[model samples]
Target: MFTNPEQFANATKTLFELQMNTFNALTSKAVDGVEQVIALNMATAKNSVKGSVDAGMELSQAKDPKAAMDTAASQVQPAVGGAVAYGEQLKVIIEDIHKEFTEAADHHMAEAKNTLSALIYDVTKNVKPGSENAVDVIKAAIDNAFKGYEEVTRATREAVKTVEQEIAKATAQVGALKPAPKNEAAE
Candidate 1:
């Protein structure tokens, strides 16, 4: 029934692209959680540093006994250490999340490619003997399928870039806090 080879290629391409987009969308939601974790870590780190610096300054200026400064320093040290640990752990989490998405995408992409190949095989096998028209139809279908894949991939990549930008912004904001003056009395 496939008279136009080009039309068949287009259809196969459309189907593959459609499915790929659906796959990316599902993965993105998962990736977003990782982004949030990173964001939260960053925010925590910034706040910890700011709080520590503020407390240290206040204690140091109070002319509090050496013991008071020591005590405040001791308290701040653990918060700093915790923030550092959390940030590192978050990085590992993001890497793992990305790995998972890549693996899933690879598997689905292979399946879609295989489905295209199978369709080609079926068209070439079951068609009436010496059907030149069928071969042409199959070729056209394959070509269209590839074109669709390219389009969908390009569009989704742009979207992914946008998400990446958002992630970056969120992380950057986490460390944007201004540090307290090293010499408070000078002001």
Candidate 2:
């Protein structure tokens, strides 16, 4: 449809504008979700440690060590509660983001596919029965589309693997660290 340079430039500009808007909105949502998660985690971690130690000290004054430990255990419940809340909140936020991103990607993918389809159609519409150029162009477009699909898939897999590895490493580090004692949990 964009036969002239001017029309092509305008179309490109419009596409870029739409892409920028989508990108900015996605980034904003992601940043807000991350910030909330970080804040919630920090607060929970702080309170869990502090409550464990303070309760431990208060309970330690009691004559029974087991009862004192039980009391301290009851005091350090923020982590579970916070994690539950964070999980639910983060789930919704992440789902919303995924929906937005998927919708955007689908829109672009469909458009690209359509454009290629139309280009091939146009090229073949008037070609001689054995036109070499038409066959070559169609083959090239198909190959390019397949390459693009594979690249996107590979990148997605790598990103998922990287995130999983980082999560595992963090978990291992936390597990390796010596847990806080009844009196020194926070400190």
Clash pairs detected, candidate 2 = none
Residue 179, model 2: lDDT of 43
Candidate 2: tens digits of C-alpha lDDT, residues 71-152: 7666545444544555555455555555555555556556555655655555455556567665676557555764574466
How many residue pairs of model 1 clash at the backbone? 7
The numbered model that scores best in lDDT is 1
Badly placed stretches (over 4 Å) of model 1 are 1-10, 13-18, 21-30, 42-50, 53-61, 65-76, 127-187
Q: What is the lDDT of residue 101 in candidate 1?
A: 53
Q: What is the lDDT of candidate 1?
A: 0.62
In order, what lDDT does every prediction score? 0.62, 0.57
TM-scores across all candidates? 0.51, 0.49
Query: How well is each residue in 32-128 modelled by candidate 1, as lDDT tens digits?
Result: 7667787876787697778778777777766558767666755645564554555455555555555555555556556667766766665676566
